[model samples]
Target: MKRILLLAILAGGVVTNGMAQSKGNLNSLGKNDPKAKAILDGVSKKFSQLKSVVANFVLKIEGANNSVTDAKKGTVYLKGAKYKVNLDGQEIISDNKTSWTYAKDANEVTINNVDPNSSTLSPAKLFTNFYDKDYLYRLDGEITEKGKVLQNIEMTPTDKSKNVFKVIVSIDKKNQNISKMKVFEKNGNHYTYEITSFTPNTNVSDATFSFDPKKYPGVEVVDLR
Candidate 1:
């Protein structure tokens, strides 16, 4: 079960990018440059238009010793404050009110009612609010991955308690979608999330985020709240 939650933390954290030319060279702009602000403004505007999204991808986790665990062929659903992640046949659901982490192998589930704002794991907070302020974003050089050119941005949070020490987001310039993310935690842990497919503003059902342990009769329920 701890392995599942650890995967959630990595997926929600690590496994969690821009445009233009002449103006395209905004990558060369300094932190205080107005051109940089203009570029980031455009990116932020595009980001604001995304209300909900669904994606299919693989999350690869790497340890300090370089051991890797890959959760292949997974789906992630996101709404305002709710998210459901299914990876390698296991599921984790959170509605900004309650969270359920279910392990298929052990037939056990852990439930916790939490303040959404208190968790760095919240997708809304991770994608929207954190990007709004409290961090410095600078465009890095472009790179080609999976045959697509991506604009890389480095983010460092100003607040210490956020648990994140640094982050890098690779954004697809044409679609303005995030292609990859790498997060470095203060505890010397790091996580990386790469997106293989992304569908924005899809009609994801509310029931997808619902948790009913009774549905799994023999499953053990641990109330962590």
Candidate 2:
């Protein structure tokens, strides 16, 4: 009789384990439900309409070892398909046709044309569209920051040559604006951008996106093209 009782207890244990495993799977499925997808789609649609914007930003860059560096106050001007970032007393300009990085301290500038197919420092890709063909996306969940709820979504690139390993975007639900972005590279490097303010459809002058090297006489221009 003791042998039979021992066998019954072993069988009961196996059944209990199976039920627990099944419940865990169900919970995982719930996290990927349609609610998250709806939130992502709504935010993407809102960003598609942005044509021009001018805003003040405070950029914070963190390294792989969690070392942090902060940039001083800067002004960002964006028009149609061009952008200019004035930071650290230097100006980085992309005129939709050509791009230039002007360094005031070193008195040097690097110039290159915009490569629509390549993913680099092109402001066009950073603000408007993404290379969705080489990446897959999933909505992570909702998070609250600064008393506002945001939809957090994760993106993983399929093409290894893309260099980008993962990307996370936190989009504000109420304003349909992106609050934060984190990019992780395959080399273990990462970049994060936190948006402090956003003003859409602001009228920016065309000269803001133009580059005139003659204005900076001592700066050397390096052409990367």
Candidate 3:
């Protein structure tokens, strides 16, 4: 669970050579495809115009042999620098200044201070700002699912020291929103996030981004900061 949470925070947060070759030559060429960038720019623009967003997604993890290892559903609420994520047995809430990582099973919550200006990527940033730098991307064409057209883009990180090597982003062409992201790690593990539902320009209250200790009596609070 810690590993998955870390993956969620890292630069948006790879595949084997054979698997790489199977995908295509986009990453091998190491050039940014203008068409892909344009689409990503459109997505960023659309997201920037919204006041807030609530997105529900599914996190699917796969093993080296392409078998499903584990799957969990999660939801994220975003308002400017503030965001909250609800995942299996855990909730990560941040009000742009402080963050709370709560474990439901342990009835514990860890607190830490956070810099809103930091370049770290939240699940919300993963949709827009993730492609802004250090990546070589190309349009991998399109596919139709559920009667919607989704454009596929293959992205490769220029930095070799990163744990994640590649990320395949699928964009909802018509809506100009991200629909799915398949991330491959050097460990041969695969993590895929599929947006189940997206509601933009939500009227969520600021209080939603904070964890109220009063709501849970006898909960342990660990202040790391």
| Number of the top-ranking candidate, with lDDT as the measure | 3
Query: Which lDDT value does model 2 have at 218?
Result: 72
Per-residue CA lDDT of candidate 3, range 1-225, in tens?
A: 463543362232211111222322344555466677677667666666778888888888899999998999988887876788888888888886788989899999999888545544454343333334456777899999888899988877667888878888888889887788888999999988888999998899999999999998999999998
Select the stronger candidate by lDDT from 1 and 3: 3
lDDT of candidate 2 vs native?
0.59
Each candidate's lDDT (Cα)? 0.62, 0.59, 0.71
The root-mean-square deviation over C-alpha atoms between each candidate and the true structure, in angstroms, is: 5.8, 17.1, 5.9
Highest TM-score against the true fold, candidate: 3
CA shift at 198, candidate 3, in angstroms? 0.3
* lDDT of predicted model 3: 0.71
Q: Which candidate would rank higher by TM-score, 1 or 2?
A: 1
Ranking of all predicted structures according to lDDT, beginning with the best and ending with the worst: 3, 1, 2
Model 1 weakest 10-residue run by lDDT:
17-26
Instruction: Please give the TM-score that candidate 1 achieves against the real structure.
Output: 0.73
Per-model TM-score, in order, reads: 0.73, 0.72, 0.84
